[model samples]
Target: MNLPQSPNNAPDADDDLEPVGPRPRPKGIYALPNAITLSALFASFYAIVMAMNGRFETACIAIFAAAVLDSLDGRVARMTNTQSAFGEQMDSLADMVSFGAAPALIVYQWALKDMGKLGWIPAFVYIAGAALRLARFNVNIGVVDKRYFQGLPSPAAAALVMGLIWVVDDAGIKGVGRVDWAAWSAFAVTLFAGLSMVTNAPFYSFKVFGGRRSVPFIVLVAIALGIAVVSLDPPRVLFALFCAYGLSGYVIYGIKKSRGKPVSVIATSTDEPDEEGLHR
Candidate 1:
Protein backbone atom coordinates (compact mmCIF):
# COMPACT_ATOMS: atom_id res chain seq x y z
CA MET A 1 0.00 0.00 0.00
CA ASN A 2 1.42 3.38 -1.00
CA LEU A 3 1.43 5.65 1.99
CA PRO A 4 0.10 9.21 1.48
CA GLN A 5 2.86 11.67 0.54
CA SER A 6 4.50 13.06 3.66
CA PRO A 7 3.10 16.48 4.58
CA ASN A 8 6.66 17.90 4.90
CA ASN A 9 7.45 16.90 1.31
CA ALA A 10 4.27 18.35 -0.14
CA PRO A 11 3.53 22.06 -0.70
CA ASP A 12 0.49 23.18 1.22
CA ALA A 13 -2.33 24.95 -0.65
CA ASP A 14 -1.53 28.04 1.42
CA ASP A 15 2.26 27.77 1.16
CA ASP A 16 2.51 31.32 -0.23
CA LEU A 17 0.51 32.77 2.58
CA GLU A 18 2.37 34.82 5.18
CA PRO A 19 2.30 33.67 8.78
CA VAL A 20 -0.31 35.26 11.03
CA GLY A 21 0.62 38.57 12.72
CA PRO A 22 2.61 38.33 15.91
CA ARG A 23 0.54 36.91 18.72
CA PRO A 24 -0.53 39.22 21.48
CA ARG A 25 1.13 38.78 24.85
CA PRO A 26 -0.71 36.53 27.25
CA LYS A 27 -2.57 38.43 29.97
CA GLY A 28 -0.98 37.69 33.34
CA ILE A 29 0.49 39.78 36.16
CA TYR A 30 3.67 39.66 38.20
CA ALA A 31 2.98 38.97 41.84
CA LEU A 32 5.60 40.00 44.43
CA PRO A 33 6.69 43.48 43.40
CA ASN A 34 3.21 44.40 42.31
CA ALA A 35 1.87 43.25 45.65
CA ILE A 36 4.35 45.41 47.54
CA THR A 37 3.49 48.38 45.36
CA LEU A 38 -0.22 47.91 46.02
CA SER A 39 0.45 47.76 49.75
CA ALA A 40 2.31 51.05 49.53
CA LEU A 41 -0.54 52.58 47.60
CA PHE A 42 -2.97 51.43 50.26
CA ALA A 43 -0.79 52.96 52.93
CA SER A 44 -0.80 56.29 51.09
CA PHE A 45 -4.56 56.22 50.72
CA TYR A 46 -4.95 55.34 54.40
CA ALA A 47 -2.71 58.25 55.34
CA ILE A 48 -4.91 60.71 53.48
CA VAL A 49 -8.11 59.33 54.98
CA MET A 50 -6.66 59.30 58.49
CA ALA A 51 -5.39 62.84 58.11
CA MET A 52 -8.83 63.96 57.01
CA ASN A 53 -10.27 62.41 60.14
CA GLY A 54 -7.84 64.51 62.22
CA ARG A 55 -5.76 61.47 63.13
CA PHE A 56 -2.68 63.51 62.45
CA GLU A 57 -0.16 61.43 64.40
CA THR A 58 -1.42 58.18 62.95
CA ALA A 59 -1.31 59.65 59.46
CA CYS A 60 2.28 60.71 59.92
CA ILE A 61 3.22 57.20 61.04
CA ALA A 62 1.39 55.68 58.11
CA ILE A 63 3.31 57.82 55.65
CA PHE A 64 6.58 56.84 57.26
CA ALA A 65 5.61 53.18 57.12
CA ALA A 66 4.72 53.62 53.49
CA ALA A 67 8.10 55.15 52.85
CA VAL A 68 9.75 52.13 54.42
CA LEU A 69 7.65 49.79 52.31
CA ASP A 70 8.45 51.74 49.17
CA SER A 71 12.18 51.38 49.80
CA LEU A 72 11.86 47.63 50.16
CA ASP A 73 9.82 46.95 47.00
CA GLY A 74 12.60 48.14 44.70
CA ARG A 75 15.36 46.22 46.44
CA VAL A 76 13.14 43.18 46.51
CA ALA A 77 12.46 43.49 42.81
CA ARG A 78 16.12 43.88 42.01
CA MET A 79 17.12 40.96 44.17
CA THR A 80 14.45 38.75 42.67
CA ASN A 81 15.34 39.94 39.14
CA THR A 82 11.69 40.77 38.62
CA GLN A 83 12.13 44.37 37.56
CA SER A 84 9.72 45.64 34.93
CA ALA A 85 8.67 48.88 33.30
CA PHE A 86 5.18 48.62 34.73
CA GLY A 87 6.51 48.10 38.24
CA GLU A 88 8.88 51.07 37.96
CA GLN A 89 6.14 53.44 36.86
CA MET A 90 3.77 52.14 39.52
CA ASP A 91 6.46 52.66 42.16
CA SER A 92 6.92 56.27 41.19
CA LEU A 93 3.22 56.89 41.30
CA ALA A 94 2.98 55.32 44.75
CA ASP A 95 5.90 57.46 45.95
CA MET A 96 4.23 60.65 44.82
CA VAL A 97 1.15 59.78 46.79
CA SER A 98 2.99 58.44 49.84
CA PHE A 99 5.89 60.84 50.09
CA GLY A 100 4.49 63.84 48.29
CA ALA A 101 0.75 64.33 48.60
CA ALA A 102 0.18 62.44 51.84
CA PRO A 103 2.84 64.19 53.90
CA ALA A 104 1.90 67.62 52.58
CA LEU A 105 -1.77 67.17 53.35
CA ILE A 106 -1.04 65.76 56.79
CA VAL A 107 1.17 68.71 57.68
CA TYR A 108 -1.32 71.19 56.33
CA GLN A 109 -4.19 69.71 58.29
CA TRP A 110 -2.21 69.19 61.47
CA ALA A 111 -0.54 72.56 61.70
CA LEU A 112 -0.61 74.78 58.64
CA LYS A 113 -4.39 75.06 58.49
CA ASP A 114 -4.20 78.14 60.65
CA MET A 115 -2.31 79.99 57.91
CA GLY A 116 -5.24 79.51 55.50
CA LYS A 117 -4.26 80.17 51.88
CA LEU A 118 -0.57 80.61 52.63
CA GLY A 119 -0.54 77.24 54.35
CA TRP A 120 -2.08 75.48 51.36
CA ILE A 121 0.42 77.09 49.00
CA PRO A 122 3.41 75.46 50.71
CA ALA A 123 1.72 72.06 50.63
CA PHE A 124 1.19 72.49 46.91
CA VAL A 125 4.79 73.54 46.46
CA TYR A 126 5.99 70.42 48.27
CA ILE A 127 3.82 68.14 46.14
CA ALA A 128 5.10 69.79 42.96
CA GLY A 129 8.69 69.39 44.11
CA ALA A 130 8.16 65.71 44.87
CA ALA A 131 6.70 65.12 41.42
CA LEU A 132 9.68 66.82 39.80
CA ARG A 133 12.13 64.96 42.01
CA LEU A 134 10.65 61.55 41.17
CA ALA A 135 10.53 62.33 37.46
CA ARG A 136 14.15 63.39 37.47
CA PHE A 137 15.18 60.36 39.48
CA ASN A 138 13.47 57.94 37.09
CA VAL A 139 15.16 59.60 34.14
CA ASN A 140 18.59 59.71 35.78
CA ILE A 141 18.70 56.24 37.27
CA GLY A 142 21.94 54.43 36.26
CA VAL A 143 23.16 57.64 34.52
CA VAL A 144 24.15 59.60 37.61
CA ASP A 145 26.52 58.78 40.43
CA LYS A 146 25.04 56.04 42.56
CA ARG A 147 26.95 57.25 45.60
CA TYR A 148 25.26 60.64 45.92
CA PHE A 149 21.90 62.00 44.95
CA GLN A 150 21.66 65.03 42.64
CA GLY A 151 19.38 66.74 45.11
CA LEU A 152 17.35 66.09 48.24
CA PRO A 153 15.63 62.71 47.91
CA SER A 154 11.83 62.66 47.99
CA PRO A 155 11.71 60.27 50.98
CA ALA A 156 14.10 62.45 52.94
CA ALA A 157 12.04 65.48 52.05
CA ALA A 158 8.93 63.72 53.30
CA ALA A 159 10.81 62.64 56.39
CA LEU A 160 11.66 66.24 57.14
CA VAL A 161 8.01 67.20 56.91
CA MET A 162 6.91 64.29 59.12
CA GLY A 163 9.70 64.85 61.62
CA LEU A 164 8.73 68.47 62.02
CA ILE A 165 5.13 67.56 62.72
CA TRP A 166 6.17 64.91 65.19
CA VAL A 167 8.35 67.39 67.03
CA VAL A 168 5.52 69.88 67.11
CA ASP A 169 3.14 67.27 68.40
CA ASP A 170 5.61 66.24 71.07
CA ALA A 171 6.01 69.83 72.12
CA GLY A 172 2.27 70.15 72.30
CA ILE A 173 2.27 67.13 74.56
CA LYS A 174 4.74 69.00 76.74
CA GLY A 175 2.32 71.93 77.01
CA VAL A 176 4.17 74.23 74.61
CA GLY A 177 0.80 74.80 72.97
CA ARG A 178 0.46 75.54 69.27
CA VAL A 179 1.48 78.98 68.13
CA ASP A 180 0.08 80.55 64.96
CA TRP A 181 3.54 81.82 64.09
CA ALA A 182 5.00 78.34 64.52
CA ALA A 183 2.51 76.98 62.04
CA TRP A 184 3.40 79.68 59.54
CA SER A 185 7.07 78.99 60.08
CA ALA A 186 6.45 75.31 59.40
CA PHE A 187 4.73 76.23 56.15
CA ALA A 188 7.75 78.25 55.11
CA VAL A 189 10.07 75.38 56.07
CA THR A 190 8.09 72.85 54.06
CA LEU A 191 8.07 75.16 51.03
CA PHE A 192 11.83 75.63 51.20
CA ALA A 193 12.41 71.89 51.53
CA GLY A 194 10.18 71.23 48.55
CA LEU A 195 12.14 73.71 46.48
CA SER A 196 15.39 72.10 47.51
CA MET A 197 14.30 68.70 46.16
CA VAL A 198 15.00 69.87 42.59
CA THR A 199 18.13 71.87 43.34
CA ASN A 200 21.53 70.85 41.93
CA ALA A 201 23.23 70.69 45.29
CA PRO A 202 24.67 67.27 46.08
CA PHE A 203 23.48 65.44 49.17
CA TYR A 204 25.15 62.33 50.56
CA SER A 205 22.88 59.46 49.53
CA PHE A 206 24.38 56.87 51.96
CA LYS A 207 25.03 54.32 49.24
CA VAL A 208 27.52 52.31 51.33
CA PHE A 209 26.58 48.82 50.31
CA GLY A 210 29.91 47.85 48.69
CA GLY A 211 32.50 50.46 49.62
CA ARG A 212 35.66 50.03 51.61
CA ARG A 213 35.66 51.44 55.09
CA SER A 214 38.59 52.26 57.38
CA VAL A 215 36.53 52.69 60.50
CA PRO A 216 37.06 50.08 63.17
CA PHE A 217 34.26 48.00 64.65
CA ILE A 218 34.46 49.97 67.87
CA VAL A 219 33.85 53.21 66.03
CA LEU A 220 30.72 51.78 64.39
CA VAL A 221 29.53 50.57 67.75
CA ALA A 222 29.99 54.00 69.24
CA ILE A 223 28.02 55.56 66.43
CA ALA A 224 25.24 53.05 66.92
CA LEU A 225 25.18 53.87 70.63
CA GLY A 226 24.83 57.53 69.86
CA ILE A 227 22.01 56.86 67.47
CA ALA A 228 20.25 54.73 70.02
CA VAL A 229 20.44 57.49 72.58
CA VAL A 230 18.96 59.96 70.18
CA SER A 231 16.25 57.57 69.10
CA LEU A 232 14.97 57.47 72.66
CA ASP A 233 13.34 60.80 71.92
CA PRO A 234 12.71 60.21 68.25
CA PRO A 235 10.49 63.16 67.59
CA ARG A 236 12.92 65.69 68.98
CA VAL A 237 16.14 64.05 67.87
CA LEU A 238 15.12 62.94 64.41
CA PHE A 239 13.45 66.24 63.64
CA ALA A 240 16.48 68.30 64.53
CA LEU A 241 18.86 65.93 62.76
CA PHE A 242 16.89 65.76 59.52
CA CYS A 243 16.29 69.49 59.52
CA ALA A 244 20.01 70.03 59.81
CA TYR A 245 20.64 67.52 57.02
CA GLY A 246 17.98 69.17 54.83
CA LEU A 247 19.66 72.57 55.13
CA SER A 248 23.19 71.16 54.93
CA GLY A 249 23.22 70.64 51.18
CA TYR A 250 22.73 74.32 50.43
CA VAL A 251 25.13 75.40 53.11
CA ILE A 252 27.81 72.95 52.06
CA TYR A 253 27.31 73.73 48.39
CA GLY A 254 27.63 77.47 48.97
CA ILE A 255 30.74 77.04 51.09
CA LYS A 256 32.43 74.80 48.53
CA LYS A 257 31.58 77.08 45.59
CA SER A 258 32.85 80.08 47.46
CA ARG A 259 36.11 78.27 48.16
CA GLY A 260 36.55 77.64 44.40
CA LYS A 261 36.17 73.87 44.71
CA PRO A 262 32.61 73.35 43.61
CA VAL A 263 30.72 70.29 44.68
CA SER A 264 31.00 67.70 41.92
CA VAL A 265 28.01 67.72 39.64
CA ILE A 266 26.39 64.31 39.27
CA ALA A 267 28.22 62.48 36.48
CA THR A 268 25.82 62.01 33.58
CA SER A 269 28.02 60.08 31.13
CA THR A 270 29.05 56.52 31.91
CA ASP A 271 31.64 55.92 29.20
CA GLU A 272 34.40 58.12 30.57
CA PRO A 273 37.66 56.48 31.69
CA ASP A 274 38.85 56.46 35.29
CA GLU A 275 42.44 57.18 36.37
CA GLU A 276 43.41 53.58 35.62
CA GLY A 277 41.77 53.65 32.13
CA LEU A 278 38.85 51.37 33.00
CA HIS A 279 35.48 52.83 32.08
CA ARG A 280 33.97 54.85 34.93
Candidate 2:
Protein backbone atom coordinates (compact mmCIF):
# COMPACT_ATOMS: atom_id res chain seq x y z
CA MET A 1 0.00 0.00 0.00
CA ASN A 2 2.94 2.33 0.51
CA LEU A 3 4.32 1.67 -2.96
CA PRO A 4 3.70 4.22 -5.70
CA GLN A 5 1.30 3.01 -8.38
CA SER A 6 2.86 2.00 -11.67
CA PRO A 7 1.66 4.29 -14.48
CA ASN A 8 -0.04 1.48 -16.36
CA ASN A 9 -1.44 -0.16 -13.20
CA ALA A 10 -2.63 2.98 -11.35
CA PRO A 11 -6.08 2.91 -9.68
CA ASP A 12 -8.44 5.55 -11.06
CA ALA A 13 -9.35 8.40 -8.69
CA ASP A 14 -12.99 9.29 -7.96
CA ASP A 15 -12.55 12.40 -10.09
CA ASP A 16 -11.77 10.18 -13.05
CA LEU A 17 -15.31 8.86 -13.10
CA GLU A 18 -18.01 10.58 -15.22
CA PRO A 19 -19.91 13.41 -13.55
CA VAL A 20 -23.30 12.39 -12.15
CA GLY A 21 -25.61 15.39 -12.50
CA PRO A 22 -27.74 16.19 -15.53
CA ARG A 23 -25.83 15.78 -18.72
CA PRO A 24 -24.83 19.03 -20.40
CA ARG A 25 -27.40 20.34 -22.85
CA PRO A 26 -26.63 19.27 -26.38
CA LYS A 27 -24.06 21.48 -28.08
CA GLY A 28 -26.66 23.32 -30.15
CA ILE A 29 -30.38 23.35 -30.69
CA TYR A 30 -32.05 21.59 -33.63
CA ALA A 31 -32.70 23.99 -36.51
CA LEU A 32 -36.07 22.97 -37.95
CA PRO A 33 -38.44 23.44 -35.05
CA ASN A 34 -36.65 26.51 -33.77
CA ALA A 35 -36.90 27.94 -37.26
CA ILE A 36 -40.67 27.47 -37.11
CA THR A 37 -40.72 29.17 -33.74
CA LEU A 38 -38.60 32.01 -35.04
CA SER A 39 -40.98 32.40 -37.94
CA ALA A 40 -43.83 32.63 -35.49
CA LEU A 41 -41.89 35.29 -33.62
CA PHE A 42 -41.40 37.19 -36.84
CA ALA A 43 -45.12 36.95 -37.58
CA SER A 44 -45.86 38.43 -34.18
CA PHE A 45 -43.46 41.27 -34.80
CA TYR A 46 -45.04 41.83 -38.17
CA ALA A 47 -48.42 41.99 -36.47
CA ILE A 48 -47.21 44.73 -34.19
CA VAL A 49 -45.77 46.61 -37.12
CA MET A 50 -49.03 46.30 -39.02
CA ALA A 51 -50.94 47.53 -36.04
CA MET A 52 -48.68 50.53 -35.78
CA ASN A 53 -49.40 51.30 -39.42
CA GLY A 54 -53.16 51.21 -38.81
CA ARG A 55 -53.52 48.02 -40.86
CA PHE A 56 -55.42 46.29 -38.09
CA GLU A 57 -57.02 43.63 -40.24
CA THR A 58 -53.67 42.66 -41.67
CA ALA A 59 -52.32 42.63 -38.15
CA CYS A 60 -55.04 40.25 -37.06
CA ILE A 61 -54.21 37.96 -39.96
CA ALA A 62 -50.57 37.95 -38.94
CA ILE A 63 -51.54 36.99 -35.38
CA PHE A 64 -53.55 34.06 -36.74
CA ALA A 65 -50.57 33.10 -38.90
CA ALA A 66 -48.37 33.15 -35.84
CA ALA A 67 -50.82 30.93 -33.95
CA VAL A 68 -50.77 28.38 -36.78
CA LEU A 69 -46.99 28.44 -36.81
CA ASP A 70 -46.96 28.12 -33.03
CA SER A 71 -49.06 24.96 -33.26
CA LEU A 72 -46.77 23.55 -35.90
CA ASP A 73 -43.51 24.12 -34.02
CA GLY A 74 -44.41 21.89 -31.08
CA ARG A 75 -45.87 19.16 -33.25
CA VAL A 76 -42.86 19.35 -35.55
CA ALA A 77 -40.48 19.14 -32.62
CA ARG A 78 -42.28 16.09 -31.28
CA MET A 79 -42.54 14.41 -34.66
CA THR A 80 -38.87 14.90 -35.49
CA ASN A 81 -37.75 13.85 -32.03
CA THR A 82 -35.94 17.14 -31.73
CA GLN A 83 -37.59 18.45 -28.60
CA SER A 84 -35.31 20.33 -26.27
CA ALA A 85 -35.53 22.61 -23.27
CA PHE A 86 -34.36 25.42 -25.49
CA GLY A 87 -37.21 24.80 -27.95
CA GLU A 88 -39.78 24.78 -25.16
CA GLN A 89 -38.47 28.01 -23.69
CA MET A 90 -38.27 29.65 -27.07
CA ASP A 91 -41.83 28.59 -27.92
CA SER A 92 -43.10 29.96 -24.63
CA LEU A 93 -41.47 33.34 -25.22
CA ALA A 94 -42.83 33.52 -28.73
CA ASP A 95 -46.33 32.77 -27.46
CA MET A 96 -46.01 35.53 -24.89
CA VAL A 97 -45.39 38.00 -27.67
CA SER A 98 -47.73 36.58 -30.30
CA PHE A 99 -50.73 35.81 -28.15
CA GLY A 100 -50.19 38.07 -25.19
CA ALA A 101 -48.56 41.34 -26.12
CA ALA A 102 -49.55 41.56 -29.74
CA PRO A 103 -53.29 41.11 -29.25
CA ALA A 104 -53.38 43.54 -26.36
CA LEU A 105 -51.53 46.18 -28.31
CA ILE A 106 -53.57 45.58 -31.44
CA VAL A 107 -56.89 45.86 -29.66
CA TYR A 108 -55.75 48.92 -27.79
CA GLN A 109 -54.67 50.62 -30.95
CA TRP A 110 -57.85 49.61 -32.76
CA ALA A 111 -60.17 50.68 -30.00
CA LEU A 112 -58.84 51.24 -26.50
CA LYS A 113 -56.28 53.98 -27.03
CA ASP A 114 -58.86 56.73 -27.09
CA MET A 115 -60.28 55.86 -23.68
CA GLY A 116 -57.61 57.89 -21.85
CA LYS A 117 -55.66 56.22 -19.02
CA LEU A 118 -58.37 53.64 -18.71
CA GLY A 119 -57.32 52.27 -22.10
CA TRP A 120 -54.22 50.67 -20.65
CA ILE A 121 -56.12 48.75 -17.99
CA PRO A 122 -57.41 45.97 -20.22
CA ALA A 123 -54.15 45.79 -22.10
CA PHE A 124 -52.15 45.41 -18.91
CA VAL A 125 -54.56 42.83 -17.55
CA TYR A 126 -54.34 40.82 -20.75
CA ILE A 127 -50.56 40.81 -20.89
CA ALA A 128 -50.44 39.87 -17.23
CA GLY A 129 -52.89 37.01 -17.74
CA ALA A 130 -50.95 35.71 -20.70
CA ALA A 131 -47.73 35.79 -18.74
CA LEU A 132 -49.30 33.98 -15.82
CA ARG A 133 -50.91 31.41 -18.08
CA LEU A 134 -47.69 30.62 -19.94
CA ALA A 135 -45.70 30.38 -16.73
CA ARG A 136 -48.22 28.02 -15.16
CA PHE A 137 -48.22 25.94 -18.32
CA ASN A 138 -44.49 25.43 -18.11
CA VAL A 139 -44.65 24.44 -14.47
CA ASN A 140 -47.65 22.15 -14.93
CA ILE A 141 -46.89 20.64 -18.29
CA GLY A 142 -45.57 17.47 -16.71
CA VAL A 143 -48.60 17.00 -14.47
CA VAL A 144 -51.58 17.93 -16.61
CA ASP A 145 -53.80 15.63 -18.63
CA LYS A 146 -52.65 15.41 -22.22
CA ARG A 147 -56.18 15.48 -23.60
CA TYR A 148 -57.15 18.76 -21.94
CA PHE A 149 -55.66 22.11 -21.06
CA GLN A 150 -56.04 23.54 -17.56
CA GLY A 151 -57.17 26.83 -19.05
CA LEU A 152 -57.84 28.41 -22.39
CA PRO A 153 -54.72 27.97 -24.48
CA SER A 154 -52.90 31.16 -25.44
CA PRO A 155 -53.30 30.51 -29.17
CA ALA A 156 -57.05 30.10 -28.84
CA ALA A 157 -57.23 33.20 -26.67
CA ALA A 158 -55.39 35.15 -29.35
CA ALA A 159 -57.79 33.83 -31.94
CA LEU A 160 -60.71 35.05 -29.88
CA VAL A 161 -59.39 38.61 -29.73
CA MET A 162 -57.91 38.75 -33.22
CA GLY A 163 -61.00 37.09 -34.63
CA LEU A 164 -63.05 40.00 -33.33
CA ILE A 165 -60.74 42.50 -34.97
CA TRP A 166 -60.79 40.59 -38.24
CA VAL A 167 -64.58 40.39 -38.32
CA VAL A 168 -65.12 44.06 -37.49
CA ASP A 169 -62.53 45.24 -40.00
CA ASP A 170 -63.83 42.92 -42.70
CA ALA A 171 -67.24 44.39 -42.23
CA GLY A 172 -65.69 47.69 -43.33
CA ILE A 173 -66.77 49.27 -40.09
CA LYS A 174 -64.73 52.40 -39.93
CA GLY A 175 -63.57 54.71 -37.14
CA VAL A 176 -63.94 52.13 -34.39
CA GLY A 177 -61.58 54.28 -32.39
CA ARG A 178 -64.20 56.99 -32.25
CA VAL A 179 -67.13 54.70 -31.57
CA ASP A 180 -67.83 54.00 -27.90
CA TRP A 181 -69.80 50.85 -28.63
CA ALA A 182 -67.02 49.40 -30.77
CA ALA A 183 -64.40 50.24 -28.19
CA TRP A 184 -66.47 48.69 -25.40
CA SER A 185 -67.00 45.63 -27.51
CA ALA A 186 -63.26 45.26 -27.87
CA PHE A 187 -62.98 45.86 -24.14
CA ALA A 188 -65.32 42.99 -23.32
CA VAL A 189 -63.58 40.60 -25.71
CA THR A 190 -60.08 41.45 -24.49
CA LEU A 191 -61.14 40.98 -20.88
CA PHE A 192 -62.82 37.64 -21.52
CA ALA A 193 -59.99 36.25 -23.59
CA GLY A 194 -57.41 37.45 -21.09
CA LEU A 195 -59.15 36.14 -17.98
CA SER A 196 -59.93 32.80 -19.60
CA MET A 197 -56.24 32.13 -20.01
CA VAL A 198 -55.69 32.06 -16.22
CA THR A 199 -58.68 30.00 -15.15
CA ASN A 200 -58.50 26.39 -13.86
CA ALA A 201 -61.33 25.25 -16.09
CA PRO A 202 -60.62 22.40 -18.48
CA PHE A 203 -60.45 23.01 -22.20
CA TYR A 204 -60.29 20.19 -24.74
CA SER A 205 -56.85 20.14 -26.36
CA PHE A 206 -57.71 18.06 -29.43
CA LYS A 207 -54.45 16.15 -28.92
CA VAL A 208 -56.63 13.04 -28.89
CA PHE A 209 -56.75 13.34 -32.67
CA GLY A 210 -52.97 13.10 -32.99
CA GLY A 211 -52.57 9.38 -32.46
CA ARG A 212 -53.24 6.24 -34.48
CA ARG A 213 -56.74 6.14 -33.05
CA SER A 214 -59.49 5.65 -35.59
CA VAL A 215 -62.63 7.76 -35.76
CA PRO A 216 -65.94 7.61 -37.62
CA PHE A 217 -65.72 8.49 -41.35
CA ILE A 218 -68.21 11.27 -40.82
CA VAL A 219 -65.77 13.04 -38.57
CA LEU A 220 -63.43 13.61 -41.50
CA VAL A 221 -66.34 14.66 -43.67
CA ALA A 222 -67.48 17.12 -41.05
CA ILE A 223 -63.99 18.58 -40.87
CA ALA A 224 -63.94 18.98 -44.65
CA LEU A 225 -67.31 20.75 -44.59
CA GLY A 226 -66.08 22.94 -41.76
CA ILE A 227 -63.09 23.94 -43.88
CA ALA A 228 -65.36 24.72 -46.80
CA VAL A 229 -67.60 26.88 -44.65
CA VAL A 230 -64.64 28.76 -43.21
CA SER A 231 -63.36 29.38 -46.71
CA LEU A 232 -66.69 30.80 -47.73
CA ASP A 233 -66.47 33.50 -45.04
CA PRO A 234 -63.31 33.45 -43.05
CA PRO A 235 -63.82 36.50 -40.81
CA ARG A 236 -67.30 35.68 -39.60
CA VAL A 237 -66.89 31.92 -39.49
CA LEU A 238 -63.58 32.12 -37.68
CA PHE A 239 -64.80 34.76 -35.24
CA ALA A 240 -67.88 32.75 -34.42
CA LEU A 241 -65.87 29.58 -34.04
CA PHE A 242 -63.41 31.15 -31.65
CA CYS A 243 -66.20 32.76 -29.66
CA ALA A 244 -67.64 29.30 -29.05
CA TYR A 245 -64.22 27.92 -28.18
CA GLY A 246 -63.47 30.86 -25.90
CA LEU A 247 -66.46 29.85 -23.80
CA SER A 248 -65.84 26.15 -24.08
CA GLY A 249 -63.67 25.76 -20.97
CA TYR A 250 -66.34 27.16 -18.65
CA VAL A 251 -68.91 24.95 -20.36
CA ILE A 252 -66.72 21.90 -19.75
CA TYR A 253 -66.18 22.95 -16.16
CA GLY A 254 -69.90 23.33 -15.58
CA ILE A 255 -70.66 19.95 -17.14
CA LYS A 256 -67.99 18.18 -15.09
CA LYS A 257 -69.13 19.82 -11.87
CA SER A 258 -72.75 18.88 -12.60
CA ARG A 259 -71.66 15.27 -12.96
CA GLY A 260 -69.43 15.44 -9.85
CA LYS A 261 -66.43 14.63 -12.05
CA PRO A 262 -63.07 16.28 -11.51
CA VAL A 263 -63.06 19.44 -13.65
CA SER A 264 -59.43 20.42 -13.58
CA VAL A 265 -57.08 19.00 -16.20
CA ILE A 266 -54.35 19.16 -13.59
CA ALA A 267 -53.61 15.68 -12.30
CA THR A 268 -51.48 16.98 -9.46
CA SER A 269 -50.61 20.23 -7.71
CA THR A 270 -50.57 23.36 -9.88
CA ASP A 271 -48.55 25.47 -7.47
CA GLU A 272 -45.51 26.94 -9.18
CA PRO A 273 -42.13 25.18 -9.12
CA ASP A 274 -43.57 22.27 -7.07
CA GLU A 275 -47.16 21.17 -7.66
CA GLU A 276 -48.78 20.75 -4.22
CA GLY A 277 -52.49 21.62 -4.39
CA LEU A 278 -53.66 19.24 -7.14
CA HIS A 279 -55.91 22.10 -8.20
CA ARG A 280 -59.64 21.37 -7.93
Candidate 2 ranges with C-alpha deviation above 4 Å: 1-27, 269-278
TM match of model 2 to true structure:
0.89
Per-residue CA lDDT of model 2 for 1-280, tens digit only, reads 6887798777677667978899875756999999999999999999999999999889999999999999899889888889998898999999999999999999998999999888888888888999999999998888889889988899999999899889889889878979778889999889888899999988898887855678889989999999999999999999999899888889999999999998877776555565545555
lDDT of 1 by residue, 126-210 (tens): 9999999989888678666676677798888988988877777666542211576667667877898799898878787766642
Clashing pairs in 2: 269-278
The prediction achieving the highest TM-score against the true structure is 2
Q: What is the TM-score of each candidate against the true structure?
A: 0.78, 0.89
Which prediction has the highest lDDT against the true structure? 2
